[model samples]
Target: MKSLSLIVLLSMVFSCNTSAQKKDDQLQNKTAFKVTKTDAEWKAQLTDDQYQVLRKAATERPFSSPLNNNHSKGTYVCAACKTPLYKSEHKFDSGTGWPSFDRVIEGNVAFSTDTTIGYMRNEEHCATCGGHLGHVFDDGPRATTGKRHCINGDALEFVPAKS
Candidate 1:
């Protein structure tokens, strides 16, 4: 009887995990963004690094992006859709090797819960194209929004502000 109970408990746990995975997959696949393109089109338009980070949710190497050290007045836009996402004034040095921002351009960015790392994190994405930009955390400047938008530089394109 003890062995049978253990088997039933294991089965229940597995089933619950399977269902949670299915839900997560559905969230990823079912969203309809303002801009949608075929995989081939995305491949042709973006470099390998851009495609991987934006479309496949892959992270670029730390300190590898030129934008991480950039401190110019500009707006950061989505690389895939060119939608304005972050303003230069909100950008900050989070020391995490990625382009960090304290806030996003409202309505241009979106958030979703991410559990791929075996823990829940708030993931950010471009609202226009549903491209994975990066993740957000509560640890940020207290003087500001107190939110760290740790964005992937490869997912962004800087547009200099007009003089």
Candidate 2:
């Protein structure tokens, strides 16, 4: 009888977790972004690295992106759709390997909850193309927005500000 009760409790816990996960997945997929592309179109347009990170939500190796060391005056645009996502002035070094920004360009980025790693994280993506940029965190420069927009450099293309 005790064994049966244990099994029942385990089943109930698992079912509740599965249902919650399903709801979260549905919420993530319900948004209609401004730009939509077929998978083949995206594959053809983006390099394998870009496709993996932007379309498949894969993370690039830490400190691997040249953009991490870039200190230029330009707008960081979405690699897939050229949507201006972050401004140079807003960029900062968070020592997190990825390009960290204090804030996103208003109206150009979107946010959703990510639970892929068994925990909740604030995921940011391009509002235009729905490309996954990276996760955001609350621990950032207190002087600024106090939010860290940790971005995948592979998902961005820097456009230098004109002289």
Candidate 3:
């Protein structure tokens, strides 16, 4: 009876450890390695609207973005990581609810294939911080390479260069 009880206790301990490890693995796989801060820290740093759009992948209304009317020459950096992702010259009026950029700052962003919406879309994010910016579509105006990167304005912060 003593040996049987010991075996049962050991099995329970092993099972608990396995369950904890599995939970850790699931969390690590869901989030990319570039994010260094905790969830609580991110929530504290970003506004509720900003967090909803940037971290939760929420989309803003069309023409409602503050960056839509921004015509100044500068660079747009990630609000979470400060990684410069777009140049002011590459921005144009897509009339989409979000800010549209024709091109990205060289090596500032990375592409991922997202199929969550039942369609294949090119998802864009900060290369340095893994923050979700938005999607890039092939349909765009003639001024660019025929690519429209429809990004969330809340995901970025514009810094105008000194003239």
Better of 1 and 2 by lDDT: 1
Better of 1 and 2 by TM-score: 1
Question: What are the per-residue Cα lDDT tens digits for candidate 3 across 114-143?
Answer: 667899888787777667789999998776
Candidate 2 residue 34 Cα shift, in angstroms, is 1.9
What is the RMSD of candidate 2?
A: 3.4
Instruction: Score each candidate by Cα lDDT.
Output: 0.90, 0.90, 0.81
Task: Name the better of 2 and 3 by lDDT.
Answer: 2
Q: Give candidate 2 misplaced runs (Cα > 4 Å).
A: 1-31
- TM-score, per-candidate, Cα-based: 0.85, 0.84, 0.77
Q: Lowest lDDT 10-mer window, candidate 2?
A: 22-31
lDDT of 1 by residue, 78-157 (tens): 99999999999999999999999999999998777898889999888888888999999999999999999999999999
Best by lDDT: 1
Q: Write the per-residue lDDT of candidate 2 for residues 20-114, one digit (tens) a residue.
A: 56644643563477778788999999999999999999999999999999999999999999999999999999999999999999999877789
Residue 123 local lDDT, model 3: 78
Cα displacement (Å) at residue 25, model 1: 5.6
Off by over 4 Å in 3: 1-35
**Candidate 3: residue 90 Cα off by (Å):** 0.4
